[model samples]
Target: MSTELTSREVCQHLRDAALGVRPLQVIGTGTGQVSVDIEGWRLQLEFDGKHLHHCGHCCCPDGREWALDSRQRFGTDPVSLLSTWELAQIEGLLRRAE
Candidate 1:
C-alpha cells in the first residue's frame, strides 16, 4: 500500500483506527465520525448528509473547532475538504498512520 492516501482513504484509515476491536458503531444512516490519536494529538472528523466537519483540537487556538460544507467549501467534493483539513490540522499525520 502507498504511504500517501487520498482524502477518502484517510477517512477509512481513521475509521479502522477508531473501530479497532470495539463494537461497530454508525453515527447515522450514512454519516460517520472518526477520531485517531497520533503522537499526542487527536484528530477528528465527522460527515453527514450535508456537510463534513473536522477538528484538530491540539492545533486550534483556544480549542476552537472548524467545519466546512461539502458544497460551498469544496464544490461538492468531499475528498478535497477532508484532505485539505487533514493537512491543515496535523500536518499529514493521517497519511503517516498505519
Candidate 2:
C-alpha cells in the first residue's frame, strides 16, 4: 500500500531540510510560495496544482541585468554581484527551502 503526503508534511520536511539557512523573502502574486534575492540571483518557488516548480536566474553585469524584465528596474540583480560559488550556495539554500 502507498500513502500520500499532506501539505503540512511537505512543509515540515522542507523546514527541516532548511534549518540554519536564511529564509527566502518572497514577493509576488497571491501564492503561498517563497523566493529569494541575494547578490544577483533570483530564485522563485511556484506552486502549480499539487506540485512545486523551482526557477532561478542569475544576472551578469553590464546592461543585461537591466534589460531582462521590468522588475530589474526596481533593484539590482544579485547574480551580477556574486561569484559562481556564492551563487551556487544561494541556489542550494533555496532548493533546500523547497
Candidate 3:
C-alpha cells in the first residue's frame, strides 16, 4: 500500500534527521527547493507544487564525486507521492551519514 505524505511531514523528517542540533535549513523558498547539510553532504528535495521533483544530488566524501539522488514521486498533491516507509528510508540515509 502506498501512503502519501504532506510537505510538512517530509520537511519534519528531514529536520529530525539533520546532522546538527539545529533544524534543516531552507535554501530556496521561492524556488520550491529545500536542502539540508550534513557533514558536507547536502540533501535536497524539490517539488513543483504537484510532483516531487527528484532531481537532487549529493557530494561524495571524496569531494570530487557527485551522485544523483533518487526519490519516488508518483501522485497528485503537493509533494505527496512518497510513502511512509519510503520517507523513513530516506531519513535513515541521513542518519547513517551523520
Candidate 4:
C-alpha cells in the first residue's frame, strides 16, 4: 500500500491542521519557502520572513490560495470545492497557518 497523500488528502490534511485537529509542523524556514509537514507529505508554504500567505482557494472571494503552491496553483480545491460558508470556514482556518 501507499502512504503518500493524494492531492485531495493533502488538502483535507491542511484543513485539519488549520483547525487544530492535526499537527502542522514547521520543519524548515528560508523566508521565501517555509517548509511544513503533516503526517508525511511536505510542502514549502510561502513566508515573508514572518507570516504565511495564500490560506485558501483562489476563486473564492476571500480565498488566498495564491500564497502557496504545492506544485502548482489551485493544487487543493479547499475553497473551490466548498459552499459559501464552507469556503469562509476554510479561509478562517488557514489564516494563521503555523
lDDT of each: 0.37, 0.38, 0.43, 0.48
lDDT of 4 by residue, 33-97 (tens): 56666565455554564434433322212222232346756635333444445445444543455
Off by over 4 Å in 2: 1-33, 37-76
Candidate no. 4 TM-score: 0.47
Per-residue alpha-carbon lDDT of candidate 2 for residues 1-98, written as tens digits (9 for 90 to 100): 32432233333323433443434443443364555443333344444434334332322222132122444432233233444454455447644545
The clash count for each model shown is 0, 6, 0, 1
**What TM-score does each of the candidates earn?**
0.25, 0.30, 0.35, 0.47
lDDT of 2 at 98: 52
lDDT of 3 by residue, 1-98 (tens): 32433344444444444333444443443366556554444546654444445524443244532334245344422124456654555445434433
Q: Which candidate, 1 or 4, has the higher TM-score?
A: 4
Q: Among these predicted structures, which one has the highest TM-score?
A: 4
- Residue 86, candidate 4: how far off, in angstroms? 9.7
- In TM-score terms, candidate 3 sits at 0.35
Off by over 4 Å in 4: 1-6, 49-51, 54-98
Candidate 3 clashes between residue pairs 3 or more apart in a chain or in different chains: none
The CA lDDT at 98 in model 3 is: 35
